[model samples]
Target chain A: MYQTNQLADATINKSESAVDVQPDLNQYLMAVASHQDKAAFAKLFAFFAPKIKAFGLKQFRQEALAMDLVQETMSLVWRKAQLYSPEKGKASTWVFTIMRNYSFDMLRKIQHNKEDNLSDDLWPLYEEAEPEPDYEDDHLMREQLIQGLEALPPKQKEVVEAIYLKEMTHQELAEHLGVPLGTIKSRLRLGLEKLKEKMELHND
Target chain B: MIKHHPESTMIHAFVAGELPASLSIAVSAHLELCPHCKAIADKATKAMADEFSGNEALVELAEPTPAQPVDEFATMLAAITEQPTDAPALKSAAVESSNQMALGEKTYTLPRALRQFSQTKWSGLGNIQRARLGLDEGDVHASLLQIDADSAIPHHTHKGYELTLLLDGCFEDESGRYEKGDFIILNGEHHHSPYTAEGCLCYTVSNAPLHFTSGVSKLLNPIGRFLY
Candidate 1:
């Protein structure tokens, strides 16, 4: 069992209200992970491909590169789905991480003109699955994280993603989101604080 | 205990895959030895996932535009699914690499991130030995630096960002003592002479050469180009 702070509860309730309006992505991912179900994978593709393209367009601003990102990212998701653990985290995170890392390596290749692939060695996809004695405790942390994600308001969540997932600067995010720079900064700070608190709770 | 770690912002950049290869390698090595920072990274990863999920609903809301080319994606999906799963260089590659480095009688197992780099043969200059890790990160240079027992480096400052991650043994400078797994970053501002009592092996990455601040050590500045 984990302790749920007030903010966490509030956010969970808000997302719960919105839950019926959205598909359960985790279920779709689990189907792909356990059964190699192509239908579930297709659903995932339909959901994430456009988002990845949008991210690529935002970053690369080139249609060819954006299309390449979509293809490569979805391909990776298909190959590595079996390695993902729902007890450890959400499917969206696992897929997003793969996309983010692949884009990072692709950008480096284009910028540095290097052929070597360094992302795998730097951030191994199977690192979390390495056998550890405290494997059971990770489930509790996962529970806490599921609740913590709900706790964060949608606006703050968007701000956090823009900064961490998109690697956007405050000014870039302000312009991209069409909000004031000060609001972006404040949301980021608040979101990071909440994230830190959640981590501390897990550590305890 | 590890006394020094990468700054939070750097760790966040690392998690976001924003850092260059050289810096990413150094931070990855440090995270292997420090669990405290790993937790923070994991938390940030979870947050990114949550934020990523938020987009699913938003993308759906903007539907009826018929802009998402479903036919092209279906083609891609069919091409991907038809291929056998045991395709790319995915799993089992991590098991083959030997992660050990030797300097005279001492042998140290390097962090996994550093193991991917094939190190050059160790060459010595006075009491210090350096082995370069050939990573392509523009102006950045990555090396495995080993100082013999009771050896001291000359007082120096960095021209650009310098990252030194202690892999084994212990060392101290003007600032404080560093044990195994300490991640120390120095720039143009700080100047320090580091000495080790027990000999230490460090993974260092820097974009520029060290500038020797002292009199006789200034001659070694020319050698810094080769070392950095």
Candidate 2:
């Protein structure tokens, strides 16, 4: 479970699909933005909608709400695609940010509709800044990062994924994993440091 | 220059949209003031996006739902493609108003992100003046605090965590001098009295009440409950 260098090599050698799809994803987003390309939109919808639905299900624990999140997120992506630029970030990053924002909005709306005493003025004030380009070709960087994650010690990987992907609080994650809170923090810190080092080394 | 900033972990949570709404707003305000943190946030966001898009297994698991009707897809496609109108003008108006927050004789130009919430009435608490921002519906409390020049807050420590964003003037505590746009976070381990030479205004959020730690101010611990 703790194998590091070997696992990194193995995962990188095996997972070629991860490296292949990102440029095409970027192109699809650009086509949708430049022209109202229905074919491009359909392709994006086919790829991202289900994954977004899975995300919503994990967060909300309700199938109907998850489906709604998928629809709302995809619709926003369509309307806002023109704002996307490869110079700023990858298409997936842009879409993921939109989905995350939409999820919060939907949650807030539900909470507001349920309680009369709560203030109705609950909208967040800040708009998301455009993503900064960290790598000239983000797809290659992503492939390396995925390989890095695969290389992490299992415990560290679990903690990193829970915090970054599942949105769990440190305390909650500790409880969920039945580990000491300090252990969770250390694991997360170490995992992130290693991942950052790997990405930086790859870029250099 | 900003002497303080939210930690990288906090910024990661903010970019991932994992923070609660009140904390998110406070971090957002800080982002507008601190370019250093904003650049870090952008990088974190890009990395998360790359990781998300690279997950071929997750994408593959989501086989196209056969149940989604063709007409529904068509309707959604049409809705998304509709041309937006006059949005830029409306956005500029909003941005223009957010720059000025009026209280008494002074008008503070706030960051654009904080301009949307309408201000509530400020209530005087000794030398400190405070107004609650009704921007979130939860247990986490957020407010604007104004301390008069040459005044000091009683020494205190937080029960959970307190995040304060300095919006105007400067204040000093045992930790260091905090100027406009400094983002400070204090936890249970910290105990300091904050003082200002020039009266300061700040946006603050706390998960729990602050516990007053010194002198006659201990009597006002109950009042500190309402202040946070």
Candidate 3:
């Protein structure tokens, strides 16, 4: 937790060895809420900042701007700890909402034009396809999601698995199901929505 | 009478962000001319990102308590809320079906107070039975009619408020094409025939009884009155 000139200078390069806290991000967020824990905040800052940066660069196309957005997003998260209703959404969802909400605002201000911040060393998120799913620890989550899907009504689950998991084209799915294309699509939308509600409840 | 035509399939693709640049351009142009589609597209755009890859989400490493996380969420939410507040979130995630689908833009989220139905033990009615979120059940009971795409609604009139939220797909009325997330509020004065283009899942919450357009629809009267 030491922050001096040397530590500040080397932290980024040494981040490779930064303790990975992928296991208890939600707990960490709760800790921040329980006690104004600066350490926990810093840990979160180090972890999410990079991801936020990548997302921002996608929207703004500038490293500095992305970084600024990250800083702002994290700062907001820090301030909104009281509103962290785990019952409503997962920690990740809350965090993502912050970024998405901010970007939406930024998009509005920029009017869909690319932000020309002219910074070096950054990459757009979408262009660099997301990393392949790592099953190492996320298996529980994946299973939980699958189980949740099973718990949905038969029709709803069918639409969700087909559209979201299998990525079946609507027409293919419609023809295959012998239902109208519109019915398939609407069912898919409704099914996922139901699943999201269930998942949020399970996590809560 | 809308300036742009709806393409349910393209909208589905656009929502998934899988449509080609050319298709996207056309969809985007259509969205500019159409607000309903814009609304559905907006939710689907975000939902798609959330579904495929939750990269944007932050894993909960530790819990923040008492904490005093920053209060920035409110301001940002306020800002978002301020951005035209015309768009409504989908009740259940709305499916885009085809990439060319165009959605509606005036959905209003029902308040928790209004959502009083048990998730368990719900029934269907005439292929569109609702689970009664306790919500507009009274009203919904009166006018809840869901039509598959390309199917025709009885083309009825209303006695009071007819608020229709296109949960998925769309139907055409004299006013125009109504798509997912689009809200159509009709009063007793308005009368139109609503037909699903191909297949649409519409959630029409109405407080008033639907007076059928034709005398033949009057046959629906004896039974339909009890329906409401």
In TM-score terms, which candidate is top?
1
Clashing pairs in 1: none
RMSD of each: 11.7, 14.0, 19.4
Q: How many clashes would you count in candidate 1?
A: 0
Candidate 1 regions exceeding 4 Å error are A1-17, A20-23, A131-204, B58-70, B87-96
Model 1 chain A weakest 10-residue run by lDDT: A1-10
Return the DockQ of model 2: 0.12
Error of 3 at B153 (Å): 17
Steric clash pairs (candidate 2): B99-B109
Ranking by DockQ: 1, 2, 3
Identify the candidate with maximal lDDT. 1
The weakest ten consecutive residues by lDDT in model 1 chain B span B56-65
Cα lDDT for residue A197, candidate 2: 92
**Which regions of candidate 2 fall more than 4 Å away from where they truly are?**
A1-18, A111-204, B55-97, B135-138
Ranking by TM-score: 1, 2, 3
Residue-wise lDDT of candidate 2 within A1-204, one digit each (tens)? 112334235335535644445545656676676665666676677678767878889888998899888887888677666666554455687788778877777776776442221111122222233323223243675668779999999989988877875455676566446689999999999999999998888888
Give the per-residue Cα lDDT of candidate 2 at A178. Answer: 62
- Model 3, span B145-168: residue lDDT tens: 345445665778888766565544
lDDT of 3 at B177: 73
TM-score, cand. 2: 0.68
